[model samples]
Target chain A: MSEMLAHLSLGFGVALTLKNVALCFVGCLVGTLIGVLPGVGPVATIAMLLPITFGLDPVGALIMLAGIYYGAQYGGSTTAILVNIPGEATAVVTTLDGHQMAKQGRAGVALGTAAIGSFVAGCAATLIIAALGAPLTRLALLFGPAEYFSLMVMGLCFAVVLARGSILKAFCMIMLGLLLSTVGTDLETGQERMTFGFPPLSDGIDFAVLAMGVFGFAEVLRNLENPEARDVVKSKIGRLLPDWNDLKQSAAPCLRGTLIGGTLGILPGNGAVLGPFASYTLEKKIAKDPSRFGKGAIEGVAGPESANNAGAQTAFIPLLTLGIPPNAVMALMVGAMTIHGIIPGPQVMTKNPDLFWGMIASMWIGNLMLLIINLPLVGVWVKLLQVPYRLMFPAILIFCSIGIYSVNNQPVDVAFTALFGLFGYLLIKLGFEPAPMLLGFVLGKLMEEKLRQALIISRGSFMTFIERPISAGLLLVAVAILVIALLPSMSKKRDEVFTE
Target chain B: MSLNKIEAAQGWRVRSTQDLAAGLFMIALAGLALFLSRDLSTGTLRQIGPGMLPKAFAVICAGLGALLAFNSLRYNGEKLSGWSWRGVIFVLGAAVVFGLTIRGFEIGPLKVPQLGMLVSGPLVVIISGLAATDVKIKELLIFAAAMTIGCALLFKYALGLPIPLAPWLLGI
Candidate 1:
């Protein structure tokens, strides 16, 4: 405990620096602006801003990016409450009761509860990281090739379960992603497997290019498809503070959300996306009148909001400790760290304690900053929502084209992104979720490497995975999840959960 | 008579065209991948080579695709939505044009000179702007101009990127 304090104090010393604080503030501000805009998400925003961070020190860049992540979460709720549009997938559940509250002239209370709940969750999750981060890193260090491979398998299975719509469709998407990831020259042999003799593809597709296309450009296409679907609330702004009754009702849900989110966020493959949905379901089940959930229950807004923010923070744990990214945002972080010649993993805490601890400290400070920015700026955000999709989409297109072109000074990358944008749109049209594909893409190379390594070590025996206790346990869990998903009764329940 | 007529309906037996198309697409992609990677050596498990994983992924994708295609026949799903040709063509066209113009293109004996960041930036913005249903000519032109300048200043001057600002023909 003393050592932990010492480390935290050191972290504070680094994060409290004027330069770092300014970076964090700027990141949060920009993050909120983009987050408030429907169809613009952190994945694309971070990818666009990646080049800007090339100029900063690793610690400063990461701190700023982390600020943008959580800030976007806070800002997404603002849009959900005011415009009935979710700026990000994590904010989807927020729209249920949040929009209703806006209709009931309780927009101010909904926004306030979200901000306060997020702040509380952020602070709690930050402490959780500070306390458990090192131990988690130690645990990660014990994982071998087989264990790592099994863990990724489990992660992919979880992704399939959590995805909306048919499990088979999601599985197909994951397989496609894995195939895409296999493009480029093989590491073992000097042979190119799927590049089709293309020179640029010899090094593989860029993550930023894929993300910008799928999340940014494809989203623009989706929004443009149905112009009338987006409706901004024009009602008068109400009081911004929650009443004592509101606070009393929200306290327990907020705590429960934070706990649930903090635990799930540690899992790989975008586990954070599951937190808010799960929390909302839990809140509805436990409530005296469940029907009030979609009708603007305070608990609905409070629980999911807290879960979203807490999950955002704790999702960083895997990236920081194990050098493994649980989601697309963390994958981008891995790319950012790589640009600075720093490989994230167990060694980061020991080698660069300041960077690790400083980032954790900045998360808390960033949350405080978000709370300040979100409350007073709610009106400004609401006004920004009035910006029509027509103008908004063009700007997004220009930025995406420019950002992608800037990556390698190659126009081919931009062209590839455009192609992926169309592909993403097609997937969405087909009721296939893109999130699992992203997870598969990010983990593909590592999973392949680990699988090969484990196989080689075991002399071609597939039983190597089962021979190891940790690997065996993880595989069992994955198998169990698949079984449960396939069960007739469970499949019906899953459909209900997703449809709700 | 109503029951017999309802049961005899035989148009679009696959229930969801979207799912059927998605499944067929996946299957085709998997087949292509397998065919392309057939030449690569799939080393044994102890010495797994590049082709091994690709082949494995192709098999899995094919299997999943088949399952999805089968499922589409049994389950009712969402209908395929109308395509926005304007949005698709203009947005994708803008990107392709920017790519070709920024660096220029050459096909056999023909050559197109690079237009640099200034020309390409506005070219992209204006072309993509045409996709919008409520495009205002004056507003769009102004936005295009502003965006080009802003991009030049931010990317080239401020960020120190080496994007060219003008064509060699301009002698800038």
Candidate 2:
């Protein structure tokens, strides 16, 4: 405990520096501004701002990115409440009661509850990350090549099972992503696998280019097809702070939400996406009158919002400790870390202590800043929301063009991003979720390396995975998850859960 | 919906055109990957060469894709939606133009000079903005200008990223 305290205080020392604080503030502000826009989500907001972080120190860059993530989630809830459009899928639950509350002239209360609930949830999850980071890193250090490979397999399986839509399709996306990851020159042999004579393809595909293309440009293309729908609340936002009654109603649900969301987030896959939905269901089931759920129940907004925020924060645990990204957002984080030339894993904690701990400490400050800035700026955000998508999307396009162009100063990247943008649109229309693919892409190289190493160590015996206890355990879990997800009865249950 | 029914009446058992297309696409993708890696050696499991993982992943992907395709025939699934050609053309056209003009590309007789971000930025904004069916030209042009200036100040000046800001003019 004392060692942990010492580590945390050192983290505080690094994070509280004026420069880091300022960067965190700016990141949160920009993240919220972008995320408040109707179609932009946390992923797109982070992808757009990714290039800007290249100029900062590693610790500051990560801190800013973390701020952007949580801030985007907060902003997503705000959009859900006022505009009746969830900024992302996770915010879909928020829109159910949040928009209804706006219709009932309780938008301020709903927004307030979301903000406070998120702040409370964020603080708790930050502590969880800090407390768990060291021990998990210690445990991760014990993993061998076989174990690491199995762990990644488990992570991929978790992603497949947890993913929305057909599990078979999700598995296909993951394989495609792995295949795409193999396109560049081979690491050992220097043999080009699938570059097709393109020079840029030799270096493998750039992460930023792929992300900006799929999430940013493809998103603009998708949104352009849909008709503009801006039902911004025209009435005055009465009060920014929740009254005592609202607070009393929200307190327990918020606590419950944080606990559940934090737990789910620790899993290897993108379990965090399910956090808000699960919390909402729990709140509804246990409510004094379950009928109040869709009718702007304060608990409804409070629980789901808290769960969403907490889940976003705790999702960092796997990334920070084990170098495994549980979801696409964390996959983006891995890309960011790689750009800074810092390989993520236990080594990150030991070698770059300041970057690791500072990020954790900064998360708390980021949450506090969110609470400080958001309550007063609700009206300004609303005013920004009225800015039409016609205007907004063009700016997004120009910005992405510049951002992609800035990376490597290659015009080919811009063209490639355009190609991927179309590809992404096709993927979306084909009922394939791209999140698993992104995860697979990020982990592919590492997985391949580990598989080879393990195979070599065991002298071509595939039983190395089975002989190793940890590897065997992880593979067992992966198999169990895939089996459960494929079960006919269980498929119905999953569909029922997702219908919300 | 009516078109789907007609297709069904035509005695084609294909249920989801979307799935069928995706399956065919994946198979093609897998075939291409395999063809490309055919020259490389897939070394034994011990000291597995570069070709091994690529082949493994591609084969698995092809298998899953085939399953998806076969299942579509067995079960009713989503129908293919028409593509937004207007949005695709203008948006992608804007991006390609940005790429070409920001740093001009030349292929034989086609000679284009570097137009720089100053021109490319607004050009992209204006061009992509036209993707929307209800785009107001005058407002879009103005937004394009303002956005370009904002991006210049933000990317070039504030962030200090060496993005070409009117290279033809400022010679930076």
Candidate 3:
């Protein structure tokens, strides 16, 4: 404990440096702005800034990028509240009561609740990172390839339950995502799988291309299609702060969400996005007046917003401890770190204590900065919404194109972005959730590689997955979840819980 | 905003578009996966063929495509309809144009000789501008030219990416 405290003090010493603080501030501010914009998501922003980070120290660059990630989480709720648009997948739950509250003349309270809840969650998650990150890393390293494959299978099971539509639809989306991930070269044999003899595709699909196309460009398409459909319902901002009653009602949910999110955030794949959705669903189920949900409930906003931020902050655990990235944003951060010659692994803590501590410390400071910046700037952000879509969308288009192009400085990536955008928009229109698709896309490559490696290690023994304790446990959980979800009673409950 | 109104708003036209789009994409993906799965020559258990995992995934994708088509066909329920093909085309078209001009045309400020920034930059802007709801000639030209020049300066001079400035002038 004394050593941990000393290390934390050392971390503060580095994070408090003038240059690092400045970068952290810039990242948080820019992250907030980018998050507020519907199309300019955190992943794209980080990828766009990747080239720029090559010039900075790895620690400082990471601190800034980390700030941007959590800052985007904070800012995402602001849009979800003021307008009914969720800037990121995690913020989808925020829109349930956030925009509803705004329509009900409680925008201020919704914004305030979200801002405060997120701050608390961020702080809580940072503490978890400081306390548990090392131990978690040790445990995570115990997970072999077979274990990881099983864990991902379990994660998919959780995703199917949490996804908005039918379980079959979600399963279909996941399968589709996995297939897309297989499009690149096969790593074990250096053989091309689905490249179709296209040299550009031999390297595989880039995350930036997939994200920009699905989340950014597809969103633009959706907006343009229904310009009037989403007529900004006139909302008068009220109660610049959360009322006592609001805070009283939200405290318990906020704490619960923080804990849930922090734990899930450490899981690989898109568990960060799943945190808020799960929290919202949980909160609603436990609420006395469930009907108040989606009709302007403060618990709905506070719980999910807190969960979203906590998840965003704790998500750094995997990146810091293992070389594995839990999400795309962290993957880009890994790329940033790799470019700076700082290889991330379990040794990151011991080898570069300053970088580890400084990053953790910066998350606390960055959250503080977000709270200070976001609350006062709510009006300013709302004003941004007034900008005609005609003008704003073109800028979004330019950024998306430029960002995708820079991935390899190759035009082929840009083409993929367009193709994926069409694919994404079509999915959205078809009642298919792209979140599962994306999760599958991100996990697909890793799953394939790990499965192949496990086979290689075990010499084609299918029992290898069951032989490993961790793998066995994870597979058991996957089986349990599938069984529970398939049960008639549980399926009815799930339908009621989601569609309601 | 009422539940009935929301449900009424989503109709068959929107559902059909979604079905067709998702179905087509799935079919194409399924075809690709199946094509990739073939001709796998595995040597030994220790050294698994690269195509093995991908082929398995392809079969899974084909199964998913069939399932998606089946779902759409059986129960076309509670669809999120509101088709926006115009928006889709505009964004897609812009991305394609960006790729073609940069890679295929090799058109940039530095390579264009005397008319580099003046011509290539404006073209980039104009193409991006085409995605907007209304195409204003003056505003499009001004924004396009400015954006093109800015991008050229940022990418070419500042970052120093190896972007070709001219296609016709510097033929080796």
Q: What is the per-residue lDDT of model 1 for residues A1-500, given as tens digits with 9 covering 90 to 100? A: 88889989999999999999998998898788877887667776676667666667889988998888777777788888888878667888999999999999899999999999999999999999999888988898899999989988988888787777788888887888889899889988889988888898898878777877888778788777877566777776699899999999999999999998888888876788888989999999999999888999999999999999999889988888887788777877877787777888888999999999999999999999988878898888888888777777777777778778877788888889899989888888877878678778878888898999999899999999998999999999999998998888898888876666
Cα deviation at A273, candidate 3, in Å, is: 4.5
lDDT per residue for candidate 3 within A398-453, as digits (tens), equals 66676566656777787788898888887877778776777677677777778877
lDDT per residue as tens, model 2, A348-435: 9999998888989999999999998999999899999998888888888888888888878999899999999998999888888787
Candidate 1 C-alpha lDDT tens digits along B1-172:
0123454465337777788888888889999999989999999988998899999999999888887777676666777788898988888888888887888889799887988877888888888889989888788888889988887887777767767778676543
On lDDT, who's better, 2 or 3? 2
Instruction: Provide the clashing-pair count of each candidate structure.
Output: 0, 0, 3
Stronger candidate by TM-score (2 vs 3): 2
What is the lDDT, from 0 to 100, of the residue A39 in candidate 3? 50
lDDT of 2 at A293: 89
Q: Which stretches of candidate 2 lie over 4 Å from their true place?
A: B1-12
Q: Which sequence of candidate numbers ranks them by lDDT, best first?
A: 2, 1, 3
Q: lDDT, candidate 2, residue A172? A: 90
Largest DockQ belongs to which candidate? 2
Q: Could you tell me how far off, in angstroms, the CA of residue A36 lies in candidate 2 after the best superposition?
A: 1.1
Candidate 2 CAPRI-style tier: medium
Model 1's CAPRI class is medium
Q: Output the lDDT of residue B142, model 3.
A: 67
**Per-residue accuracy of model 2 over B1-172 as CA lDDT, tens digit each:** 1245655566648888889888877888899999988888999987798899899888988888888888777567899898898988999889989999998889899988888899999999999999888899999988888999999999888999987777788896
Q: What's the lDDT of the predicted structure labeled candidate 3?
A: 0.73
